[model samples]
Target: MLTIQFLCPLPNGLHARPAWELKEQCSQWQSEVTFINHRQNAKADAKSSLALIGTG
Candidate 1:
């Protein structure tokens, strides 16, 4: 498994457009993908835009 951790550099963060872009990129992967919001203690399946929006 590959793991990475980073902060959102964008002022508006994720929203919808970027979230869809991210979802598209992650879709190319064969492994499971997840978004972990350390500050909010939230976890979401990276394939879902609605779940990612909450982490923002």
Candidate 2:
């Protein structure tokens, strides 16, 4: 498993469009991916649309 922190470069942060694109990119990777918002104590599957949305 590889942990990656995806910083939101957009002013709006990881909105719908970018989030979907991120999921697509993550899905292409061979390793498992997961995203965690340390501040919010939130976690999500980096490859799932629903989970990606939860990151926002």
Candidate 3:
């Protein structure tokens, strides 16, 4: 499994467009991936757009 933390300084945080793009990229990889937001205590599947948005 591989995990990464991406800190976004953008005012919008991780919105639809960015989340979709990230999900698309993650989908192409073979490894298992997850994103966890320490501040929010939220978790997201790196390959899923809906899950990413739900994390926010």
Count of clashes, each model? 0, 0, 0
Q: Write the per-residue lDDT of candidate 2 for residues 1-56, one digit (tens) a residue.
A: 44456565555446777778878988998887887766557778888878867765
Residue 30 of model 3 has an lDDT of 89
- Best candidate, lDDT: 1
lDDT tens readout by residue for model 1, 1-56 = 78988687776457898888878888898889999877677888888888887786
Candidate 1 C-alpha RMSD relative to the actual structure: 1.6
Clashing pairs in 2: none
Score residue 35 of candidate 3 by CA lDDT.
Answer: 74
Q: Please give each candidate's TM-score.
A: 0.80, 0.71, 0.81
TM-score, prediction 2: 0.71
lDDT scores of the candidates, listed in order: 0.80, 0.73, 0.79
- Predicted model with the maximum TM-score: 3
Return the number of clashes found in candidate 3.
0
Clashes of 2: 0
